[model samples]
Target chain A: MEKTTHVTSELNINNIKSFLEDIESFIFDCDGVLWRADEAVENAAQTIAFLREQGKKVIFLTNNSTKTRNDFLHKIKSFGIDCNIDEVFSSSYGAQVYLSKINFQQKLFMIGEKGLEEELRPLGLEIIKNFEKTNDGIDNVQHIEPDHSIGAVIIGMDTSYTYQKGVYAHKLLAENPNILFIATNTDPSYPVKNGKSLPGAGSIVTMIATSTGRKPNAIMGKPEQLLLDLILESHSLNRAKTCVVGDRMDTDILFGVRGNTKTLLVYTGVTKKEELPSFEYQPQYDTRTIGDLFTLFQKL
Target chain B: MEKTTHVTSELNINNIKSFLEDIESFIFDCDGVLWRADEAVENAAQTIAFLREQGKKVIFLTNNSTKTRNDFLHKIKSFGIDCNIDEVFSSSYGAQVYLSKINFQQKLFMIGEKGLEEELRPLGLEIIKNFEKTNDGIDNVQHIEPDHSIGAVIIGMDTSYTYQKGVYAHKLLAENPNILFIATNTDPSYPVKNGKSLPGAGSIVTMIATSTGRKPNAIMGKPEQLLLDLILESHSLNRAKTCVVGDRMDTDILFGVRGNTKTLLVYTGVTKKEELPSFEYQPQYDTRTIGDLFTLFQKL
Candidate 1:
């Protein structure tokens, strides 16, 4: 196929294995490289098992803010993949950490999924004006009251995203420029089953950005250094020895390149082989899929 | 006292009067200049009357997409300001004209106020899915359906702006790159009663822009030449003899400056006299308020 002819120049099984020899740690993106929805990638669980057997430390990093570290851990374990709760670094987990790092003790306004709220609320933060949580039969923006005590506004993917929320957030951010704006992830949309994708945290964040004319003070997802900082802080990760692997180039490969970590892009997720030429960042290695990496592992 | 001290350098009553001597046509911004909400600005109607009595043509121009030309005409008449329907130009009115100019004949999707819909629907265009119109008690995005018949997505300020509407628009635009995306205006917020402002059409427009990663094909409002083109085409407007009077420098003054017409900034609206030094665009004259310009009109 075209993919074989395309990647033949710079990538092959032998070259990929030789490149992995010096890499002591392997960072795997959960969504596309390991599993899509409930189904695991072909031979992906075996690939991680083989890597673990080879004394290579494996880490699961994701920009998905819908899930907390515990949620991701449970999902990873169900797939027969070995993962510790501490080994999982998700944007939702990073959000609470980021807030704690900044010492933001004031009330928090959340516009994300339940998992994001779950990870954040445990930080002992008071939730502001549950206007959204308590609908109160109010469909009008004027009826939607404002909470002056709100200090930071955090956003992720919410199935219950509404226009009323956008207006209220706009009013708060506009009136008080001192409010801390945080975006858990700016992925415009996340892919679902059957090739259909729904709006992501970025879609909600963008609505606020348009209304308030402000960007997030801190972005807690991949492509940003915050997640990598969290991953590196706990573990003695060497930029040269740790290889970052993911499906997307913009978020995964770029994150690695920016952090000086070796990156290997897999074909199991969002990006394609042909797209590698168009992107500003290039992965050190790419294969047919994450399953292909398992084949190299079997040879050794 | 602060404003008087601020304008002593490049603005004065004698200097302002001399600059207005050569102007034959006056283009006035409706909001903050002529009126604020239901109440007319102090002496704004008298200023227009004085200018009209002096044989000068006065036209009402506004970037507010929430109102149609006819609606503005009524509002202008309510304040005892003499104005023909043709003299009133709003962003919503310009939007229909822009669409017709491009010969766009297809089903449309909208995420704006009722006035924008009123101005646009009269063009005889078939509207796409009515998920918003017929809410059907469905709050979830997955339950929301898509319409393939959509050819263009127009945005204004929708009081009913919901996350569901934003998601559907994002889906249609993402699926079809050929779809026309238009923004009625980019005014961030409009000043409301008691010094408070609500999110404007631009907030809704920005949300879609973020969701789709695309800018509008045409922005029909102040500071853009489209409105001026429509104004010039309809009337015998000589750019050199025309002067645009308004309170906001970013929109009204910037619009006039770009159109090669003289600009006069007034203190009756959003901008302050002290802030004039920081802006890139400068008006030929600045006074305490629009009523100050009427003072020189009496000398004739």
Candidate 2:
């Protein structure tokens, strides 16, 4: 395992104060950093309020594509945190912005849920409609020939993922090499309400990747630059002064490292204290929980 | 990229005569060698007929688990080849034999088609039935706890593979580390009627494997020792006098090498003339077609 740099000491008042002073905006990963599933972490609400009180921009960037932006805002507000729909930046939203920026004019062959479809609706993007309406209905495995009009294939968290969908995506990629293949996120699994995690879009993408022999041209999620770019485009944030806080090292901390922003690792999520040594790129600061940063906020 | 031993000479009359005299039984891969998908190669039927007339025991071995032994026999007969159901050995049959050998008495969690189920019927193995009767029906995503009575999870080619099936398999494996995870074959794709191939058992098994983070305990198919063991147990053949013949090196040819049998490579299928040098275990004999082996039979 590759060794990564580690912050040996716990962030106390002086360290927290300095860290807080250096950053103007805070980007948070929701599932692990803010709360586990639906239950919020201790002092999670307080930490966000404190950051807002200091006039720091708080952005909740999540890779959960199952829900729409409004759904996330509702969930966050339900947790007693002041949030706006615009403050919630999901991978689906990032993909919509990206497609618009590239001026993609072709129809998208979508293999996701209504949330993803809803995201595309705002952009006026046309979609190759699904054959099946619901899981209860027939999969009309129509043996449909490859459609040249379909220039892109987008996939997210789809519970109704079927063989037909995979076959169609494979056919499109096989027919045209230039067809854009984009995935919302590739997180292997996501935590559910019961503490157990379910297979994420990454698994679905992997299945299609195995069948088509083509990887996604772009993964519009954390660790990738697109999500960060989406955040930067919407908010005026100084990269040098911004800090990204998350539990997972691979997606969260690596996202910060790739963007050249400060990163704070919280131990309440996927990453553990013992596993920090094996990381290839360590975060800049380590704390027990997101609430631990409150001591620094108090010092100010 | 590993260099394997290669036989550079084409088998003429003398070489074929000697090769024929040395092998009492011939194990053949059905796809690519004897036939390509449904159509038999130019002289495949004639070669098999000649071998049978010479009193050689021929086995039609395939990894395709979609069809039963009777189905294979019917197809072979349709191709004008003399064959019996007893001569056909599919991966589904291999799994049945393996489970019987291990005295697997517990219920099996089956993720395959009717062909695989038919193979298990003779052994009196009970299966934890799937929730959905068809692909259009509800997946039943039943949150059934791990049933300790289930000892093995067998997977083959299933077009109706769903997220619920993957989740259930993962849960079963997670609940019991000792439970057997058996896959029919891991061939990424298999040839269909149109010369195009569809995702095979390997892809479905891979999806479950990815979600479970556990590789199958046993993969009962070509390239694995279990398939060769099943063939040897059913037939009276001397290892020194047996020749395994096929087109693909990774599965068919490798099976022969691992079983300590001589192998004959045919160029009528997947492995072409240019691919011989790159194999890690090259066949001992090379021929343009199965009909080329007739030169030895003529000498007899």
lDDT of each: 0.78, 0.79
lDDT of 1 by residue, A1-300 (tens): 111112322446557567668889988888888898668888888888888887888999988887778888999999999888878999999999999988888988888777888899878988652475434121346455578799988888876666667667777787798998899988887776656567778877877886677888889998899988888878878768998988898789888888888778888788988888777557877776777767865665
Q: After superposition, how far is residue A40 of candidate 1 from its true place, in Å?
A: 3.6
- Name the lDDT value of residue A261 in candidate 1: 84
As a whole number from 0 to 100, the lDDT of residue B124 in candidate 2 is 88
| Superposed model 2: Cα runs more than 4 Å off | A1-9, A132-146, B1-3, B132-148, B295-300
Q: Candidate 2 has which clashing residue pairs, if any?
A: none
User: In candidate 1, which residue ranges exceed 4 Å CA deviation?
Assistant: A1-11, A37-39, A77-79, A132-144, B1-13, B16-18, B37-39, B132-143
| Candidate 1 displacement at residue B145 in angstroms | 3.3
Docking class of 2: acceptable
